[model samples]
Target: MKRTLVFGDIHGGLKALIQLLEKIDYSKNDRFIFLGDYVDGWSESKQLIDFLIELSQKQECIFIKGNHDAWCQEWLENDVVNDIWFLHGGKSTIESYKGIDSSHKEKHLEFFNEMKDYFVDENNNLFIHAGFSSMHGPEKEHYKTNYSWDRTLWEMALTMDERIQKDSLLYPKRLLLFNEIYIGHTPTLHYNVEIPMQGCNVWNIDTGAGFYGKLSCIDIESKEFWQSDVLQTLYPNEKGRNK
Candidate 1:
């Protein structure tokens, strides 16, 4: 079986990320999937992005845009969007690239632009940065933007049951369509736990790494998780404060 190493929501923890990679013993044959949010909450956003870019050049890596990444992309597109992006952890992202040249900013933007919204393997394992919409049929097939900010769809899926709810409006038919959906953005109580919901079809891997949470990774086939040690005081107390 192919081994895929999946991680996301780094929130700028360069040290923790390095440690985690060492534990994995990453190799040329393995594939890495990063679910986005490479910046924010911690201080190493720029470093992490740079490392990821370098890693992508040598090995297989798939990057998806997170909400934070979208903010950065918007800022890069126009200064008019700076205020909006800054409010959502773009401030830290800017700080991460302090003293860098315009070329660096362009590079980061290019990387973000190329990220995929979702990755589906031949086995039908779907990997998305955020959860999908709950609405069934055509809504599920809509482009990336629809899935990125659609919270209602995610809420419906999370609350839906596994048995006897087919085509029910209260629950989503889309959730039942995938072999497994691996997602970030919603943190789990424990970093090592996969937080299976809706009959183990959906796995939440965020582990709150940006908000007093640990960085986490999962072995997709085994459904086993690995995480950094807890660091309660790592994040700022101010609500939405950029670290």
Candidate 2:
């Protein structure tokens, strides 16, 4: 049977990602939904994008845009580099492109530009890089940046009382808009866990590849998941985002 796989924030851990795919025994029949932040963490950001481009040619892929991706996209498009992006792992991303020329950068830039802020499957399963704030839904989100930057939605889910049933008036209206929501951006490490986390109807798959955690993926239907070696071990000499 074909699989619908959802991957969390990669943060440039190319080796971890490769290990994860091999562990899962990836096939062309698998449908991949990658929650972005593909760049700005480790040394292989450029190579990671190259691999994704090639993979897309052979398999179905849906790439969601994350805040880091948005920042990298701007740099690629206009040569802009701000301090926040720099301190947060953008420097490694820039260094990764040392020998690359304009043509290659342009292709990668196009890849980043084509990424979607969010994707919704027929089952009303929402896939996005981050949370949406609007009570109506992501499509109706007024601050479009919320698609890649919002955290309040996840925060609300975390605070939800399990005893408070979904049908209750106290239930969050935003969570009701979708059957299930899958996202990345806020690392689970912040919550002191190195595994995928579920809060209400939302699943946070970003297991913190940008820091001490590992890269992760989930078989959305089965809820079975896989993870790579901790990124810090994979790139032992590098500090990653922990710096």
lDDT of each: 0.69, 0.93
RMSD of each predicted structure: 3.7, 0.8
lDDT of 1 by residue, 84-197 (tens): 667666677777778977898789879989988878888878888776653452235565565455444445556555674655665446766777777777666443443332
**TM-scores, one per candidate:** 0.82, 0.98
Write the residue-wise lDDT of candidate 2 on 197-216 in tens digits. 99998999999999989999
Instruction: Report residue 157 deviation for candidate 1 (angstroms).
Output: 3.7
**Candidate 1 stretches greater than 4 Å from native:** 134-144, 162-171, 189-200, 231-243
Q: What's the CA error at residue 48 for candidate 2, in Å? A: 0.6
With candidate 1 superimposed using the best TM-score fit, by how many Å does residue 196's alpha carbon deviate from the native?
Answer: 7.2
